[model samples]
Target: MKAIVLYQQGGIDKLTYTDYATPEISETEILVQVEACAINRLDLRARQDRPEVDPFPHILGSDIAGVVADIGPRVSEISVGDRVVLSPNISCGQCNDCTDGNENLCSRQKLIGFHTNGGYAEYVAAPANNAIFIDQSLDFSSAAAIPIAYLTAWHMLITRAKIQPGEDVLILSVGSGVGSAGLQIAKLTGCRVFATASSDQKLQIARQMGADFTVNYKKVDFSQFVLDQTNGRGVNVVLEHVGQATWQQSITSLAKNGRLVTCGVTTGNEGQIDIRKMYQKQLSLLGSALGSSSELRTIIQLANNGMLNPIVDQTLPLSKAQLGHQILEDRSNFGKICLSPTLSAE
Candidate 1:
């Protein structure tokens, strides 16, 4: 099997494309023939320094859409040749959090590609239960773009913030995968969306995706722009993932009793808050992780129904995984960047 194996994490150069043994499935696992895999910012951090990379020669890709090439003896629900997308979160189903449908909070949860070997290869193995069936009409690349970005956005806006129709919602960095997904989800829920980006081109793209207002954070204060747009009332919900860089502004951009749900810390992690202002405004600061498997299922259904479209800015061959990481590092893409084993690097 051809794979992007990381012998030791350092830089993009460490991601070497080479032949490796195909993964073997346990009784409860399934071997998937990789069709498409999506690159994420997490991949870059893991490649650089985030101590979660396990075992030697790790394969890094969590958003995977592929066909079931073989199944374990105990895997009865899925069979060979099934078109599927593997849920990135692997949790202990018997835990209290898992039983309560909050598997993202389970103590025993493991993220694919981070805690285990993942889909940067011709074939990879995953738990059979993690496989979500996709419609025959749904393309693999699109399905591959859903797990991390869309799932996190859905959990943040729909489950955590509980945004309502006609409300004003603010989405930061509307060009990245999760950011773009958040923009779509806010628009789908009938909210007036305020999006922020680093470039005019990304802002234009955000407008095309239903953002009511767009601001270039590089040029102006985004929170002030949101306030001005909303007539000083600010927004009801702020989808904040960029950490320390935007934390103060995100809090300032929120209305009284506004909810700010965050998922990632692409910037520095530590953030300070004005305790007096937080109490006076009655603001709610929420932290969200990836998402539950059930939420992933809902995202897949939405994609299948065409209610939510996973934006693919570009697709490269699996052999070009280093280039994919470089694109993410530069933050040059408007949406998800995918890698396909079926494509030729040339």
Candidate 2:
């Protein structure tokens, strides 16, 4: 089997494509023949030796879509030859958080690609519970892109913020996978959506995805634009993922009692917060992580029903994993970048 191995965490160049022994499946796990994998900011951070990186020679990928080659002995719900999407979130199912359906917050949680080997390879063995079966109608590329960005956006807006129809929502960085997903989810709820991107082309795509208004943050102050558009009331919800760079503006663009839910900080991590403003406005600041398994299922159902879809920017062979990582790091790609493990072996 061939895999993208991080020989040493330094830069995108460290991601080398090489052959490796196939992993053995545990009793509760299933062996998946990976077809497609998606590039994520997490992958970039891990490659650069961010604090999130595990031990050396790590396989970095989280979003995977593939076919089950074999199932472990106790895996009763799934079988061999099943088409599946890997969930990436691994938790101790017996823990209190897991039992309560908050697996993302479990104390023993370990995310694939971050803490363990991931799907940047021909095959991966994951817990049977982490595999979600997909119908033949969906292509592997689309299925591979759903696990991270879509799930994170669903958990932030729908689960945490409780977005309602007619409400105003502001999504930052419309070019990002999560940003695109946020736009689609807000639109699905019939909310008036405002999205920010770095370029006119990306903003146009956001409009096609149902953003009511688009702002090129590189050209204008997004917070002022939001206030101007809403007659000073500001937006009802702010879907934020960009960290220190946009945090202050996101807060200022919110109306009184507005909800701000965020999951990632691709920019800097630390930011200043006005305690007085927070209290006076009675604002709700919610920090969300990757969603639960249930939310993943809901996102898939939404896709299956044609209410949502993955915005794929480009697809490359696994040997070009370094190039995919470079595209993500440069922030030039407008949506998810997918990689084909099978093509990497060629």
Candidate 3:
């Protein structure tokens, strides 16, 4: 098998496409012939060895769309030759959080491409439970974009914040995959959505995705815009994934009793907050991780029904996985960057 292996974590240069041994599937696992994979911010962080380091020669791609080559014993729901999308979140099904239907909070949780080998290869082994069968109507590239970004946004907005209709929602970095997903979800909930982007081109895309208001953060203060738009009341909810860079402002741009949910911190993770303001405003801060399998299923249904759509910036062969990472790191793309592993020539 040919894979984009991280010989040593540092930069995009470390991601080399090379021949590697195919993984042997466990009795409870399935062998998936990789079709497409998506690049994520976590991939950049993993490449730089910031959060942590995966073992050398690591395959780093979380969201995947592929065909099942073989199914392990006891996997009764799905069978071989099934077109599927990887769930990305792997959790201990018997844990307390998992039993409580909060698998995203499970103590034994591990994200593929982060904690274990991922789908940056021609084939990979995954637990049968982590495979979601895609409807034949969907393409592999679109299926590959769903697992991480959409699921994360769904969990943060719907599950964590419980966003309501007629409310106002502010999303940071609206050009991002999760940000685009957040915009669509907020609009679907009948909320007036405001989004911030670094460029006017990106802001236009955000507006097209259903954001009621778009702010070019490069030219104006987004916090002021939010306050002015809400007549000094601030938004009802803030979708914050950009982290420390926007953390304080996100809190400040919220209405009284507003909910703020965050998933990742791309910028350095150190921000000061006003405790007095938090207390006086009665603000609620929530931290969300990857979403549950049920949430992924719901997102799939939404995609199928045309209620939600994954924004794909570009598609490349898996051999150019490093290039995909570069594009993501530079923020040069509007949405998810996809890699087709099957197209790689070993």
Between candidates 1 and 2, name the one with more favorable lDDT. 1
Separately for all candidates shown, the number of backbone clashes (residues 3 or more apart, or on different chains) is: 0, 0, 0
Q: What's every prediction's RMSD, in angstroms? A: 0.8, 1.4, 1.6
Model 1 scores worst on lDDT over the 10 consecutive residues at: 48-57
Instruction: Please report how far candidate 2 places residue 51 from its true position, in Å.
Output: 4.4
Sort the candidates on lDDT, descending order. 1, 2, 3
lDDT, model 1, position 42: 89
Candidate 1: tens digits of C-alpha lDDT, residues 55-120: 677999999999999999999999899999999989999999999999999999988998999989
In model 3, the runs with Cα more than 4 Å from the true position are 50-52, 344-346
* lDDT of each candidate versus the true structure: 0.93, 0.90, 0.88
Which candidate gets the maximum TM-score versus the true structure?
1
TM-score of each: 0.99, 0.97, 0.96
Ranking by TM-score: 1, 2, 3
Model 3 reaches what TM-score against the true structure?
Answer: 0.96
Error of 1 at 74 (Å): 1.0
Error of 2 at 160 (Å): 0.6
lDDT of 2 by residue, 1-346 (tens): 9899987888767888899878899999999999999999988878886776664678888999999999889989998999999998999999989999999999999888788888888998899999988877788888988999999999999999999999999999988999888888888899999999999999998888778999999999999999999999999999989999999999999999999998878888897889999989999999999899999999988786767878889889999998898888778888899999776335
